[model samples]
Target: MPLSERKVVARRVTLELANLVIKYGRPIVVNLGVGIPAMVGEVVAEEEVEDLITITVESGTWGGRPLYGPDFGVSLGAFAVISVPDQFTMYEGGVIDAASLGFLQIDAQGNVNSFYAKDRIPGPGGFPAIASGAPEIYYAGLFTAGKGAKYEIGNGRLKIVSDGEIVKFVKKVDKVGCSSKVMLEQGKRVLYITERAVFRLTPEGPELLEVAPGVDLEKDVLAKMEFSPIMRREPEQMDERIFGHRRMNIKKELLKAIRA
Candidate 1:
């Protein structure tokens, strides 16, 4: 059976986030949040760059492939499994080099709403500590919401069969689970990654950075957002390899990038 569109998008997002490790050019530790962010650890394992990139989970497991869904809090080959409090201590101490988290809503001011909406209240979990402590953060999630949103993937491109009825990027989020003001005060680097586009949090607002292939800038992106994002210049196209079915050979790319 072919992979679902959601799974494909998750892989695309994972590849892009994994590639970010190369930019650091040295060994680093990263906390992978639940949902789409958990997929990054699997990609790191597949690419065999475990030695260069350490994966940590909120459940206190470190240096292993993070599992998702029912196995969400555990790892496959974790080198260490400390107490949950200890894990949080590491996060709060700014020991984590980077973090990738999922978001429910993000506003023009770059505030993230992760775990509360109307009657839904999953609480913030470990998001606050990780978001405020990590020097760099990559917020990953789908571009839109609602069951109406549909997509097709082929030929190294994305096709929006039908856009989601609900827009995630809003003029103001329902709640602020991660505050841009706090992140800025700590000098944290923040980027929001989705299936169709990437944005960087700036003093002005979220700045458009990259758009996926086959996506319409006006129809798919700008039209779907609740507010206009800062576009300093023409946004570059996302890495084409992200849409392809073949392996991206991320390990080779990371090593090459480090050598450069």
Candidate 2:
């Protein structure tokens, strides 16, 4: 299938987030959420850090490279597959360090609506258990979704192909898949990652943390969202490595780290 501009940009976001998770978080057990978040494990596998971080999915597979799309449950190089009950036990016991998942809607309260909308009712799947159990949760998706949604990456920059009609960040969600207030009260950290920007959940709401290169903060990002994010005085620009056609050398570094 031909990749969409949004998917291209989202892949870059996933690569960037995966690198951060490897460096700063260094999670020993991580669950790469479905959809855009699933790419995190693919990038990790490319980086060759499978041994360092146990890549797992909600379907009970562990230490394997996750497959995307319709073949999601299948994996390569998996260490083992446990029963569903055992997997949830691990998740509920706070064994997962981080979970990178997809989102359909996020509200000012940081509540997520990944499942169950007016047109769609796929249900939360394992989102509730994963969201509640993980110490840090990252929601990954495009800033907006609908007709005309598109983008491009070139010359170490990002350009919009066509803006999507729907805004994802809102004042309220149609249904709460994971309650932001409840998660925060448990002292868990939450972050929302988009192709254009990254937002961290604060007491007030989602706070802008970083903006992508060649992106206008006001016109490209803030103006596109339904709700206003708590902006940093000078938000950090997204890593240049995430843009352009260059291949990242994270695998080399991962091998080196392992050897040491």
Candidate 3:
């Protein structure tokens, strides 16, 4: 795959993730974790749902329109900025509607291991507080990491360069940064959205919900996970709109839903 086409797959994956989040609708408030999770805010801005979504950061920025890249820590048109402690109060009090956060490793039990992986960065920051409180949690990231995993776009679907040496979906994570067991017991809705598939947490385990086009459910997804997920009888192919090169009219749809 050419470098240019690889870029296309990368962009499409990120946008697909953002679109996935929008389906949950605009919550009264939400927090977006760093990395690809933060990129979702960029898509929200593009979809013109900033007012509807109200993106928050761990740095005490509430109701701030998220700014990606170098301007990430600051919001473009912020409504308010409070102290760190006050923000924690909000998270701990279960005020956030949803929290979209990054993932390193996840297990059958839904435990996440984003903080203690070797050969990668270590730190949970405010992930625990955000995940524990948010009624809905979207674990956002690629399906594979390390090794030589790469992506390309062709035939309206994404192609993998090489299956990465490391598989992110494991039987047990290196450490439990956020306890999926606790969240599941509390009856929170937890989802793992990757570039190729989506899974929902269930009493049994992670349940397969959707898979991207051109991906093999058995070869690409099921084969890579350390534990077998509960396969939906008829798992849906991710929507075609998720692969488009242009921004979707999610703003219009969201506004219409609000009015209705």
Best by lDDT: 1
Comparing candidate 1 with candidate 2, which one achieves the higher TM-score?
Answer: 1
- After superposing candidate 1, which stretches have Cα over 4 Å from the reference? 1-21, 257-260
Model 3 TM-score is: 0.86
Tens digit per residue, CA lDDT, model 3, 1-260: 12233223234434443444456544457787876677666666666767777778988887656765566667766778999899999898998877888888989887888778776677788888888888888888888887677776545576666678989999999999988778888888888888788889987888998888878888899889999998758788775555555555666766665665
| lDDT per model vs. reference | 0.83, 0.77, 0.74
Q: Which pairs, if any, clash in model 2?
A: none
Quote each prediction's TM-score: 0.92, 0.89, 0.86
If both were scored by lDDT, which would come out higher, candidate 1 or candidate 3?
Answer: 1
RMSD per candidate (Å) reads 2.1, 2.6, 3.7
Per-residue CA lDDT of model 2 for 103-126, tens digit only, reads: 999998888999976876577888
**Per-residue lDDT of candidate 1, residues 1-260 (tens digit):** 13445445456555644556666777778898998788777666666888878889999998978887678998988999999999998899999888889999999999999998787756999999888778889898889988888887777788888977778999999989999998888898899988889899999989999998999999999999989999999999887766766666777777787778
Please report, as a residue range, the 10-residue window in candidate 1 with the lowest summed lDDT. Answer: 1-10
Error of 1 at 133 (Å): 1.1
> Total clashing residue pairs per candidate?
0, 0, 0
For model 3 the local lDDT of residue 237 reads 78
Better of 2 and 3 by lDDT: 2
User: Where's the lowest-lDDT run of ten residues in candidate 3?
Assistant: 1-10
Candidates sorted on TM-score, descending: 1, 2, 3
